[model samples]
Target: MPMIRLPSVLLLLTLGCAPAASPPTAASPPTAAPVQAPSAAADGLDAEQQAWVDSTLASLTLRQKAGQVVFGWTGGEYVAADSPEMDRLLEMVERDGIGGLVISMGLPHSYAAKLNALQRRAPVPLLVTTDMENGPGMRLAGGYALPSLLPLGGGTSFPPVMALGAIGSDSLAYQVGRVIGREARAVGVHLTFGPVLDVNSNPLNPIINVRSFGENAGEVARLASAMSRGIRSAGLLSAGKHFPGHGDTEADTHIGFAAIRADRARLDSVELVPFRAAVRAGMDGMMVAHISMTGLEGPEAAPASLSPAITRDLLRRDLGFGGLVFTDAMNMGAVIRRYGQREPLLLAMEAGADVLLQPIDPREAVDAVVAAVQAGRVTPERLDGSVRRILAAKARAGLHRRRTTELDSVEAVVGARPHGELAQAVAERSITLVRDEAGQVPLAPGRRVLSITYAQPSDIMAGRAFDRELAAGGWTVASARVDDRTPADEYARLRALADSADVVVASAYVMPREHSGTVGARGGFPALVQSLATAGRPVVAVSFGSPYLVEAFPAVPAYLLAWGGAEVSQRAAARALAGEAAIGGRLPVSLPPRHPLGTGLTRPVRTAPGHP
Candidate 1:
């Protein structure tokens, strides 16, 4: 395979030799909010690409510019036949020329078809993107998904992305990206908001968790660069996340604001390291997280999204990132809670966000920006500048090239037999058995096996038929679901079932690292574990989300972390359970008490001393 082509500025970024950001020149009256550069000046692509972006930007009207900045989630129960919210959003595209849309969690399959229809209704073609980080099901249920990245973080042979970088196989990073890219294209997703280049140095960072590659800056940078290339080559755009860094924050932006407390100097060497690599490796866009920074703004000020100094002066001018800059979901509590249903969307634009992701109401958000422009708070020129960037981004995404797909071809493309096979293979490679103290994988023919689901049993069942796989491997499995709130009688029932079985494999699904809104894990995992812990027989804890599953419950001896709740991951777990494959994955994040992020023992099966 060909090597990844680095951006021209890679050397400066890698060496930390980037030129400093000049103080904003307030002398020139701010236009729109603040116009940085026209699409023409922004294009680093040779003359032809620059000309294309310029022509595209010039042709778009002010309404189109305003439309390009916002994307819709389209929640709320709507007309059964057609989505009322989506239809109105489409009007903004067809009548007002919106640029793109992001599909969020909790929409029915019919809703997706309606979305496809809305895209077709657009007069100026619109781009559709989704946060299919793991798989299409991440956004839409009953769709394809990979196990979370956490499982891949644990296991045996190869080092994590960090290890891969030390060897400089930018190719490995690219191959990983290729897998992501191919999977995205296969699912009709055009953009991926991942490869979280945050350099996960802090263990307590609730959100970044195993979503990041590792704690090493160079490794995170290399893999992110590789992954970005893979995504692009797959004919999609990959966005490096939290533009500056959200890794160190103890809090998650999904819930509220988090301050990094990093000065410019500290940011340069550590926090900003991965972002610099992403830009240099040609990331198509950067999503600015809702976290607050130290030197970037005042203590009482709003997030980086509302600070021109952070987004414009730092990201655009100093770092020389010229692609699309989006803010993390406008619906996030950080923006929505204080801004209280509105206003902050406009403030984000003033802060230099080219795309407003997951806005509560794109129509109203656009109108507010329009109102701001009219009121002279946001200059028309700055508005045009941001739209120019958005348009340029869409064009690069091949919005310029339209393809025809019949309804028959749609199922063939995404739901094809080959795609399923590939998904199965990836899933098999990802399953990890972190600690097999008893060495129980290769079960004897008569051994009884028990399978207990701690959380998200339904999701774990969909990817591949795990029970069937276990059955084929010559083990009898008795399966049960458990939760934190099970009554004593119910715990007794599941425990009795496990105790009766010769071996038990308890699978736990994890939450998304958000606050423990309630006291227990979803689907009563804590309760289930407590119940299972009562049984002294050999027990295995398989975590499908957090690699830290072993730490969460120290009572279990055979510990396994699948790292995600994707079908492939479960399948991989099933195959590993059957002793059909060798464990090659290791913990990507530290699991605390048991082992650090890089701990896993991969010894081969042993025979008695005189057996041979």
Candidate 2:
């Protein structure tokens, strides 16, 4: 099988030698032995690569240089060669001379074909990127076949990063990254915005909940650094995100301004720990958040993406991160609502972001930067510095050598069996039994189970996998689905239905939504759970999205934390419920009051026949 060969710097990164931000805890995995030749150069490139970057910077005109920092977006859907969409994209490349393209979602083969088409027309090779925080399947839709197993489809979508934190294995974290990287690169994605470095210190954080590795700073650092190495090893650039941290904040940046209110000393100890480790690990890039840094500046300061104090002084100077720095999507409400259109673009450049990601208007963004440079608001030197880094990243991704992806090999590489198996394993390992006061878990195989799923009306995929897995495990499952829109009168009837079952299993799918700032068990779902708890049947409450959902129905006798709403997590939760898989995950974050960090109950897998 052919593979994308990485450079020497990437090979060193694969050896897993990033220094520890702090000493390892008993629960934390030991850090790898430090390698001496860290790839801490302005760009982790060879002499030949550096020459290409230098020459590319020298050749570009001011407009092109300004456009080089402006990254545009596109859905991975098929675009005809001569269509208006393709024409607009080509103009964005030729006229605007945009440096990168962010692929949001699409089918596997079509996604690669679109990129190949664009790459062929691009004046300079475009740095194709995506938010494959979990895996490419998170965006791209479609399935692929594997021998004897259900056809593993789309890209291999793993459980969220919190799953890794629960499993607490750096090696597993690396494997997850490697799988995500390979599948992303297979689809022509050069960079993955991943290994969410946010520490997830605040459980109520609506945006960054399960996306974070865990709350502990040192553990988060160790696991994230390991994963970043795996990403680089697969020849895809990895970008640690929401720096210095978005986990400690309450507001969702996708909606409005969110602030990290930590002091500098606390920031160093918690929020910045993983980022520092990312820097030492030679991570290819860092994505600044649309978050305010109250620690560095006063009560009222611009977001870190536009704050020179946070981006240039803190991340670049103090942490010494020389790689590409990307602003969180410029179209996000935090940026658009605060600074409107043009000002944020100019401010982000002044703040030293190499790439203004997914701007609302690419032409306007380029024009704004060009005008700023002309008026001396943004210096030519500053513009050139960013352009140089952008070019260096493209070179590092081997785009300078081969711009187009092999469309024929897309399916063979993406959604392959190994990737799917790894994702399932991560999910299985991450099913943490936080509480089992009633000892109702692993409900004997023949028991009558009333499996009710609570999700938003839009989450149609929530409980299908869970209920199917439970039924396949030899249990008789009477399933009911409740969304926020489910009428209040329906719950009394649902409670009556729950009373007849030997065991009632409630699954909560409260995940983060982009524009919606709040997250929890919505509407009458919590009341339904409370009624279920009081019912004679032993109720097992499993959270497949936010671990903090337990706060809503604290009195449920049995509780399991399966992390996210991904199908893998639902299936794992079902397996854990049926004793098919062992429950080994520990809490990466505290459940608060009753459950502190690291609280979990272990259970051995049932080896008896007929259990499957």
| Per-model TM-score on C-alpha atoms | 0.79, 0.91
Q: Candidate 2's residue-wise lDDT over 350-389, tens digit each?
A: 8899999989899999999999989999999998889988
Candidate 2 clashes: the total is 3
Q: Please list the Cα RMSD from the true structure of every candidate, rounded to 1 decimal place.
A: 11.7, 7.5
lDDT tens readout by residue for model 1, 136-230? 33443332224431221100111123323222345545544554454344334467787778877776566665566667676677667765775
Question: For candidate 1, what is the TM-score?
Answer: 0.79
Misplaced by over 4 Å in model 2 are: 1-42, 142-152, 609-612
| Candidate 2 TM-score, C-alpha based | 0.91
Leading candidate by TM-score: 2
